[model samples]
Target: MYECAVLSVYVDLALGLAVTFLLLSLLVSGLNEAFVRLLSIRSKFLWAYLRDTLDGADDRTGAWLPAGVLDVFRVLPFLRDPRPRHSDRPAPAQPSAVPDPGERAGDSMINLLYERVREIDHGKRGRTSISDIPPARFAVAVMELVTAGGDVDDFLTRLRQIDSPLYGPLKGVWESAQRDLDRFTKGVETWFDGEMQRLSTLYKRYVTWVVAVLGVVVTLLFSMDGLEYAKTLLRDNAYRASVTAVAEAGPEAYAELRARCAGQEPVACVTETLSQPALVGMLDQALVSLSIPDQGAPSVHWNGGRWWDRVTTPAHWPGFLLTYVALLFGAPFWWDVLRRITGIKAKR
Candidate 1:
């Protein structure tokens, strides 16, 4: 019986952590959406990479790709060039008859790159390369925009000077571009694909940082202390009973919410789950258990209005930091932990 009592305390701690993590995830996602709207941070990375790829090359030839090629990469959101739409380039005329050999020679290197790939006999069943289609077509189109006005080097230099994350790890590729344009173009394609993979990891890092900062702010705002709250729940049988009841009912609600929010992109899914009124009400009920006057609200700040004293207390620092760091582990993690605990409780 004593062992069960101690175990219940641990379960309550996990439940608290799960609730906080969900809140943190929503905060981070909201911040990301705001950043995207304000700065176009996501698209800027692609543009900077494109600039770096075209760095240092001058187009002495007056050749340009057909205006239709500009639309080649429109299907890909990441590769889409945002600069050209805002640039002062004059509108191009529609494609007429095919140009003679000399006129085609003056086309952009990127234009030729696409042409080379198109000339390949796919009947040989050769594996697709970045230059092959879709990606290659998109790359060439964006490259034309990045290198427009023969200012590839200047464009990337400006992006680098601005110190954006979009200029990530492309110094070597740009340096190589100075020596061999073909190799530079290929490296750019490779780097773009590689960066696409890295983008996922980078986004998580941003969210982790956002969650940590937001966790600290929230803890300060609510005067939350993980350790003190745990102790309070353990000492008060009524409070623990209320929490247990809520937790016991959480599994089915969570499962239903999960099913409803499944198949969405990460940001959208988290936003949807966090916004659900049913889930929000469940969390509110659990919080009520912690703050009810008869239950002797776990933290004194709940009853006493000494917000500064609660915020400045040294003993709460460790618990505050613990919550902040746990937030970095993210909501899905705590949700799974709570789910396992609930499963064990169900069996018993």
Candidate 2:
């Protein structure tokens, strides 16, 4: 027969770990995003491909069209800036938040190419530039950018100059569409769609690696001796009970927090909640209940020796494994598990 009290304690311990992993996931995600932006990997790849595709002839002057295609959000006004707006005036330093620039921009390289092509074909249509070009008309815009009253041979010559390794796979696609100018633009768009999908896969893998690295760093910073923490959770009845209460209360609190951040779709809610003081306080409270240190403490008790001990101790393996590896699954998985477990507990 299983002891009901022991089961309840274990359940709570699991929930507490879930909460910890969720918070770590958020932190990891934010750091990874910053890292990606700092390197400008996505934008660089996008711009490089656009430049190579449009100015493949190495014609710096003719590359104007591809060089001017702006970012999607900047081009489309109705889409709106999903992030919160802040004033230009300096404010008190707070949690790390990405800088948000409100609406104001010029043509992206693609849009620039569109504008130049449109100018050559029909002259100024109005005050509007290629940034205002609709998605459906993108292929049309590309066709104009490439042809612009020129022969198919000239168009192919410009495209041939794009020898970048990233464009290697699309070479065949481009070659097939070259003979037919009308189909060329459509083919290019199709190729771009495929490349975007590839990029999406690549980025997800990068984010996963970043999350794992950050997880380890976070655990170390907290002096989170997984083995000792596990022992406390299992042996100290009062501590386990307190952590269990917090775990039971967490989901409802999280739901309320999500409601408060109600804005655009998924991303807006996540960003807003992450920046909120209430959410931070709740996480801090939960961490305290679980006897986890968040910020660095003055005492040097939890140093290299404790870390070494945790790694060597056979008994601590379960808790250590959970703490280190849980983050690889990401926060959503753990949250889902917590919800299912709580639901079962409630039913009983």
List, in order, the clash count of every candidate structure.
Answer: 2, 11
- Reference-based lDDT, residue 275, model 1: 46
lDDT (Cα, tens digit) per residue for candidate 1, span 132-207: 2334544454355446434456545544554423344445676877746666667767776775665446444544
Give residue 255's lDDT in candidate 1 (0 to 100): 53
| lDDT values, one for every candidate | 0.47, 0.47
The weakest ten consecutive residues by lDDT in model 1 span: 61-70
Model 2: how far residue 153 lies from native, Å: 4.3
Q: After superposition, how far is residue 309 of candidate 1 from its true place, in Å?
A: 2.4
Give TM per candidate.
0.45, 0.50
Per-residue C-alpha lDDT of model 2 across residues 277-325, encoded as one tens digit per residue? 3223322322222322446653323245545554466775565566677
**What lDDT does candidate 2 reach at residue 326?**
67
Please report the TM-score between candidate 2 and the true structure.
Answer: 0.50
